[model samples]
Target: MSENIQKKIEDLREELHQHNYNYYTLDEPTISDFEFDLKLKELQELEKNHPEFYDSNSPTLRVGGEITKNFPTVQHQFRMYSLDNSYDFNDLEDWEKRVQKALNKPVEFVAELKYDGASISILYENGKLKEAVTRGDGFQGDEITPNVKTVSEIPMQLHGDFPDRFFIRGEIYLTRKNFDKINKRREEEGLDPFMNPRNTASGSLKIQDSAEVRKRGLSAVLYQYISSEFPAKTHWELLQKAKSWGFHISEQAKLCKTLDEVKAFITHWDTARHQLGFDIDGIVIKVNDLSQQRSLGYTAKSPRWAMAYKFKAEKVETELEKVTYQVGRTGAITPVANLKPVLLAGTVVKRASLHNEDIIKKLGLHEHDFVFVEKGGEIIPKIVGVNLDKRNPENPEIQYIKTCPECGTELVKIEDQAIHFCPNELHCPPQVVGRMIHYVSRKALNIENLGQETIEQLYREKLVENPADFYALKKEQLLPLERMAEKSAQNIISGIEKSKEIPFEKVLYGIGIKHVGETVAKKLAKNFESIDE
Candidate 1:
């Protein structure tokens, strides 16, 4: 690669990096996906044709498209604690009594919206954004500062006075509007949409390229100041200060003086929560007085000063339109119920996972059958049971398919198994991609640079068909492909090489052998000496 090509690669990297920072952290994208991809492709093409000229900061490497053998732990500055939960009014009432007793007077509780998403801690120093980390098991978390910096609402610099080290806790959420749009785009592009907003938010945060994070449109809401120099006597006061600092704080907070008031606040939101734009699972109640909070202390998992008042799932009767089949990556054929679009748990429920063929037969479901659909775990809408009386004789009974939908392979039902599997593991295109994905999974070979989309691209391009073929990939072969750069290819090669020296157990697990899990693979590795053995 010539110096001119190297310079061009560096320039492209800087440009893409700037765009990603602007879009993700600033929430102000100036270019569309097509435009960004076009630029990335151009850079990739340049670096591919000249392997020596690849830049590490290029947008294509954001996925880290390389495998990570291990995730080194880092202890947190403060203990990342969990919140105590109260499922019933009785439990909540008891919690209020404890708070009142601790205070020795009438206590005012601050009730805020509880988000159903990934918890993150944002640290700032000298009014500039410093680090962002996940609440990993409440003790230590992965340093995702680079990825977290892309979140737009999380200010890179504080608005007011600078603090030495301030930690703020927030929920990273994907809005209903953005989620729908993302799914719609996925559908149009013939890709499976994300299972839920929580999954999407988690995946988006892990993207190595800061530019990719900007495109996902993730939002954050600061609820608690974990550690701050700014002193506040109550949770409500801390929220006010957070709002002043330009962090998005919950507006639905209510100050209640008694258990009755707290109950009223919870009850009001139970029905009215649907009006909110984002997904909120419950109300988080915190003791207003800081002294009482300190005295209450914490349990092993959750803090006693705080309790989540979860809303009950709303169930309604709806007609089962039909039952469909979805093939899993493992070739398991699971049934899905097609329901009449009905509002459930603040979202429209058109379909629900049916688990397996056994469930379909057990439900005795048929078309135009009146079925009671309940919001499973307050998220997924599931068919609880069918009202046989409402079943019309004119409608035909549901039947499971004998063949795989994609490859027309004969589906097999093994003994003692509920799911039907398509036995064409090696022949089926989906299965091939699935196997490749498993081999490159985090817990297996830990190939960090490989991604589902990239695998699909390789499959579509006929560059690879099996796990072994991945090892044969060369720098020249990757550079010519869209979005593949010299640096990206090298990174992937390095990641693949790192996988070779990993324990035999990981290699065994990566093969996706039937009846062999991580524990079994470890056992096999311990018995064997090498990967070949």
Candidate 2:
């Protein structure tokens, strides 16, 4: 690389790093969108020219950030679990009968609308909110206490004389009013709106900035207390007591005495649930008696005493308009099936992923063919199959692309893997950007203030070409950037310096290796003599 080009790269990383900290951690911005873009563009061009020298911790790999090889295992006080789901009244009745058989007596049931949002465990100690954790893998969750305290519904202090240490299980959700308002504003600003209230609510709660949490209007309603010492006799009674402790309890919860009553309650909500302001994917039916709940116990993944009745999949038939290949950050090219717009599951279903070339060929999917689509897990909807009977006589067989559209590079298929990859590496701008992002992510380098946009900005401005270049940055270099001030530049430098002292495992994960993740990286770190080793 030319001396000037290397110097330019160093200057860019410093500026971008400062911008990332300001926007992501501080929730403040010093630069304009256009200026940031210019910086990111420059960094990407330089990396493309010198692919061999690119560093792993560059700020380009944020989206599609892969899972760490493993998370440090955290065992819970009581087993964290999921709920068994039922769809309609018949299924609900079946569950009720099963519960009756398990209890071997007259069993009273507690019915509540299962909130379609993030599940969290709020910890209270001596009448104060001590910690808030995500129900991550039903074991341990990220400690998001700072962000959780910003939600108004989450009481700072407990109302009742609850035990010194207790856990309240609740679904944190965004209100319909807040959801619509945010979407409307995004639309006005020409930004893609949030898909659903549940996703937005979850994203809002998990954001690093507590100030951002305040603006999102997130709310939580307590459903159950996972306390070992609570003296509550029944599930319904426990919920009622939790309400007295100032938790936002569900108002529609009903205490059912018979299987018939459970069926009736399920049926009532099936029709009336959408009337509520927030989204609810299903209803939960729990054994009312606390003692019975304890006796029935938990399975590997969920509680045996309770089950959730999920709504049926809503599907629609649409024309297979076009199939496009999207290269993921990891360089995997996934085939996305674009469809003629058709309404399904309260939203328009336009495109679905074909997963891989095998799936496309298996379905014999061709452009303009009619296909049935349904939202799986109420999230991504893909083409179930093509109507071969409706195939046009004039149109030809659809062949998958053999090379990446962006770089004209031959796609590589790893042994025993379905996904095709573009081998361009640093030459591919998107992948370069993706790698940079992964390097600076929260769990990796943990540079608190960096974000996706700033990474893109740094790439455009030619400020940083690789992760190692970040270490060579100077504060004076950043002051010339559009929004950067001396103070902000110094903060970025400080964060970058602090990140250098992080464990080698984090640096390894930040590099965006194909199969290596945090857990595997940690294992490697423990065994290896040095980072290079």
Candidate 3:
């Protein structure tokens, strides 16, 4: 209740807010990082002692992103739309012509980098963040506000925002630095490294634990202001206004007066885009005039006013060390190429998918052959061709894997599928262990303490055989297992107890059924009243 403390609190809030605005938006900060940190720490201490003085706008709210058990899907205020794609400049010219024909005049365009990450919609009600939504099916999305808050780049509370309702659209991306670090951590933990940043970013948002999402150190950038209570006249003006509101805005945006200028912009960044920290597949060209965009309207799937000028997949030559086959939970065998660790796109490439024996044979893939690899969809690395010039004629002809890699059984090829299948589903160690791992994965039963290694050990000892056996584990049984301490056993028991209360859909997913994913499981669970039926 002291006037001096209140004054100091108010002053610090204003100071920190202004500094953040300067640093994030304006790119000019009066205070150094340490000075700003000290002020923020002081304000946090004061707010801790006097909770009444704390407000939503306080900088401290940015760090403590909440944890939630699940993310409920929410309907978007505005139906999110994708942009029509263009692979070449001719397509861009044709698109520009369409815009001109629609508007009866030449159109100006704003060309910006198209980030290869999850598209997110953030709804700010009365200048406060309400929901961080995924672009699920365009009409509806999952509300991942808790996990989104963990991204410090995404401001929890906007600064100098006047909109009563703000519908902000942006990309939630993992930086190359963070992606590498995350993969390193995954490798250290004996987990397969994430294939790409975009998918990882997408998958991370849905994790039940927001704390894990925070540890991923996700980042975002605001490009299209999507919607707001206060409508802007032009795309450039909207971005400028968004910048002033303490949002992370990309500096690569440029307003072009003609199609030629737009082409020049795209041509300029085609090779230079690799310099950026984040993954960008192409440039998004949009009609700068908002009125023109509205008049141009939209197609069934995408906005006619905007076009994503996609770049060709970058390819590099790397020696194929060998081919490795993996057994899926469904017992389908997929061949993978072990490459001589080459750097592709923005990340390192140690291996690439061969897809099937058909691909391997078509490419004439042989041991110690020079192979040309490309990032399929600019996310996954794959061997596209065999460089015959560097291959030795004396090398043995390409011999595809004929038997199951794990089980000593002959692999069978289905009539239509190019993939080989291991028929030893009942006794194959990999199939059983893989199925068990899939059953307890995060999207299924979500058993916390039971990892793939533990599942394999249990399977080896014949302690558990089916999904139902997971629910029947005892403390005595766990006590006999290697590295299973009393506390660890109790935790596993607790985790299993918690998992039992999960909805029917999770149970359906946990059963390791063929052709049933999360969506299918949800549909099945909704259709069937009970499992016995």
> Model 1, stretches more than 4 Å misplaced?
1-72, 188-190, 228-230, 326-334, 364-368, 377-380, 388-399, 403-410, 414-417, 421-533
Off by over 4 Å in 2: 1-85, 93-110, 116-221, 224-238, 255-280, 286-308, 387-393, 446-451, 457-464, 468-505, 520-533
TM-score, ranked from best to worst: 3, 1, 2
Backbone clash numbers for all candidates listed: 11, 43, 0
lDDT of 3 by residue, 1-533 (tens): 57888899988877776776677667787989999889889998998888877676566666655667767888888999988888997887787777888899767889999998999999877766777899999999999887887776776556665577778899999998999899775533233578889899999998877778888889888887776334679989999888777788889999999888888999989888888987888999999998888888889999988999999988999888887888876788988888899888767898998788888788877689999988865345888888889998887766877889998799999898888999999888777877777777776777787887788888988988877788888999999898999998999889889988889998887787778888899999999967896
Q: What C-alpha lDDT values do all the predictions have?
A: 0.77, 0.74, 0.82
TM-score: which is higher, 2 or 3?
3
Q: What local lDDT does model 3 show for residue 132?
A: 86
Instruction: Quote each prediction's TM-score.
Output: 0.65, 0.59, 0.70
What's the candidate order when arranged by decreasing lDDT?
A: 3, 1, 2
lDDT of 3 at 236: 93
What C-alpha root-mean-square deviation, in Å, does candidate 1 show against the real structure?
9.8
